[model samples]
Target: MSEFADQYLCAFRQTPAETELHQAAKRYVSEAEAYDRTVCTGPISKDGILPATPRELALVNRNAHALLTRIADAHSHLFSRGELLREISRVDRLGAPA
Candidate 1:
């Protein structure tokens, strides 16, 4: 596993009880780590790239995006509107994302 994945495991300490959440978090971290690796490693097209099959990629992207938004919304007090706006701008810069 990647260091980021390991870090997540360490921080989250997943158990068999929350199997679904644990699996979802694992996928999100794994995908994020793959994205980071692809970007940082060299000249590679980050778009149209994914960890598993195209369908899996779509699922990962959809679920991860939804979970991230929920996390941000739930912890809105932890972030300012300006910061959130900047984040949205960053995502926009990435591409025409939803």
Candidate 2:
């Protein structure tokens, strides 16, 4: 189970302009969509830059988890049960958290 994501940052309402999470989510979605549209859907290249190795991928995963954990810790009071449940469901679909 995703213990980290179960308590990851899902909301941020500090000052009147709490858009960090929203912007991060937007950027993530945009980049992912671009990856899908350009990388996955585009022509394949055998000699192009190869995908990240397992070790590299693991490093990235760990870094992301650490960053999210910090954000969640800093903004713990902003999170809600509903948001956390949604995060749990989302992370559960991915097998486990990093």
Candidate 3:
């Protein structure tokens, strides 16, 4: 989450906009999206191993919960910005908050 915030801030800093910690907010939402895309996708079958089963699904859910908790703690009000708001609209259009 902190890294997300840092990256968002960096992006804003690239421009001349004075984001004023709003970058942190954008970062949080971006992190959520990234996690959803990268980690939430079920694992692929490996070698002769099968894809993730129900047990693996449960574990993935648990780990995702923990990771989100940690991210929220680290980024507090990371979604308190216009950029994040726009992202919310974009994501909501796609479906859930993600």
Candidate 4:
């Protein structure tokens, strides 16, 4: 697994949340993995770019947005801005953008 995946799994293990946030994170990870597999298997264009199909793009975007919103909603009220930034930094160290 990649560092990001390792970090995500670790986060899930370490943090406690309501069902919705947990599920959202799980879905985000699932969609990300799917995107990774798609990129690995997707066809390259004539110009050499690996363009995603509209459906694939939509799925990834939707899941990513949902995950971010869920994370924010789950933590925003509980954590101060500095605390949130620290958490975000930790997650960013996973080497993936949110």
Off by over 4 Å in 3: 1-51, 80-98
Comparing 3 and 4 on TM-score, the stronger one: 4
What is the per-residue lDDT of model 2 for residues 1-98, given as tens digits with 9 covering 90 to 100? 48887788467555522344343333333343344343332343532222345654455455545555555555557664344435544543443323
* Candidate 2 ranges beyond 4 A from true positions: 1-51, 80-98
- The superposed Cα distance between candidate 2 and the true structure at residue 23, in angstroms, equals 5.2
> Highest lDDT, which number?
4
Quantify all predictions' global Cα lDDT against the true fold: 0.49, 0.44, 0.46, 0.51
Per residue, candidate 1 scores C-alpha lDDT tens digits across 66-89 of 756664465455554345445544
Error of 1 at 20 (Å): 24
Give all TM-scores, in the order shown: 0.33, 0.37, 0.34, 0.37
lDDT of 2: 0.44
TM-score winner between 1 and 2, please give it: 2
Q: How good is model 2 by TM-score?
A: 0.37
Give RMSD (Å) of candidate 2 vs. truth.
13.8
Candidate 1 ranges with C-alpha deviation above 4 Å: 1-50, 81-98
Q: Which ten residues in a row have the lowest lDDT in candidate 4?
A: 11-20
Candidate 3 Cα lDDT to native: 0.46
Could you tell which candidate, 1 or 3, scores higher by TM-score? 3
